[model samples]
Target: MPDVRYVTQGTRAAIRRTTREDGAEFVRLARESAAFHRPWLTLPTTERAYLHYIGQLEREDREGFLVCVRETGDIAGFININNIVRGAFQCGSIGYGAFPPAAGQGYMSEGLGLVLRHAFGPLGLHRVEVNIQPGNKVSIGLVKRHGFRLEGFSPDFLYIEGAWRDHERWAMTSDMLDQRTGAG
Candidate 1:
């Protein structure tokens, strides 16, 4: 059994397990960022939708979710390492969104690094992928900073903001992770 621990940056921000206690805060951030995220995110039904989303996170397979917090304990973002696959592939994809207030603060970047390490190391995953909207320069830069390579582009890859949009595929393998540490 693997454990999900809190990740932090000095005393500024933290990432930890999502809990029922976070329901209200999560809902607030999700709603507040609806406009900013509507272009890339799937629409939710209601305020309680996060409860259902949290339920999915408890599964032993398929998905995992985390909550990002500011030093003041405000929930600022959400991240997930989902669609996990094992055996021959040993892969998964990352998805995330930050509240309008939290964007550009490097909170997601720090959280991503911590989670990706666990995904490849303790989880024994070989590859992780990120599908970023071509127009989302912030996300593209984040993935690239983490050593993910641009694999290709898929037109109409995701249906977002009412129509299908192109997404650039980026991937990082365990070998690539190792290379970053001179262990490959």
Candidate 2:
């Protein structure tokens, strides 16, 4: 089973597995951060869609959570690794977004590093990919900082803002994770 520990980074933030019980809080955060997150996250403008999305996230094995916040309980960010597959393809893709207040504070970076270890080590994933819109410099930097290599450009990889968008493909293998953070 996946361990859902309450993770901490000094007084910076904590990351824990999200549950259906967290629906209201997650919705509240998503609503409040809509303007900031909408460009990257598919924030539902309606309560019904919000509930449906969270429900799926709660039940799917293709998903895992890294719900993060300051020690004071302020919502900082969320990390999601979804669409997991095994067999010859022991890999997954990651997506993340932070509240405006948390941007550039290294919270997302730290949370991502921790989650990568969990994905590649305990989770036995061989590779992880991050797909960022070509113009999302913030996420591009985050992936690069963690030693992800630009593999290629994927056309129409995501639908964001208003239409389908191309993304710069970045990937890291378990070996790269070990070298970057010495987590192995």
Candidate 3:
């Protein structure tokens, strides 16, 4: 049975805020998906580490959501909107990961679309940005499909896996999303 507490629902997937209860399952998925996530991500795969990871998400500036398969209620991925800035700049940075059995099944795509809606609607965010490693073509394609514009390139933008990495900055504003969906 699908969880009735979905924050947003799509055709094949639903997203809900990630909680402490998700740690064990998330760790299992992460550990199992290690090969799929290497170089691009370094998620917690142990229970203790997972709890610590979850703790950081319990902040005013962060929103963590799990993308669940609507049919089986299996966790397909996770999306997080971080560094929320209110006041003059209503923006957030989005990061996500798609796990095994759901990586290439379009579930994450559908889930991401729902997340964008939630971000613009209830979250009241005007702009959202994704900074991805330059070599990560799959991630780049995902943002492109979602109508995020290629902003610029940032060299040594983020430190990952003990080294500075180059990143391509992609961004989408509420207006851009509106225009894409012909809702503007």
Highest-scoring model, TM-score: 3
**TM-score of every model?**
0.84, 0.86, 0.97
Q: Once superposed on the true structure, which residue ranges of model 1 sit more than 4 Å away at CA?
A: 1-12, 43-45, 67-70, 182-184
Total clashing residue pairs per candidate? 0, 0, 0
TM-score result, candidate 3: 0.97
Instruction: Indicate which candidate wins on lDDT.
Output: 3
Quantify all predictions' global Cα lDDT against the true fold: 0.75, 0.74, 0.93
In candidate 1, position 67 carries an lDDT of 43
lDDT of 3 by residue, 40-138 (tens): 988999999988888878989999999999878899999999999999899999999999989989999999899999999899999999999989999
Candidate 1 lDDT by residue in tens digits, 1-184? 1133564333355667777776776777677678888678863435568778877777665455454554555555777877888889999888887776878887777777767777787788999999999888888998889899999999988888789999999999988878876764
By TM-score, the better pick of 1 and 3 is: 3
Residue clash pairs of candidate 3: none
Whole-model lDDT, model 3: 0.93
Residue-level error in angstroms, candidate 3, position 151: 0.7
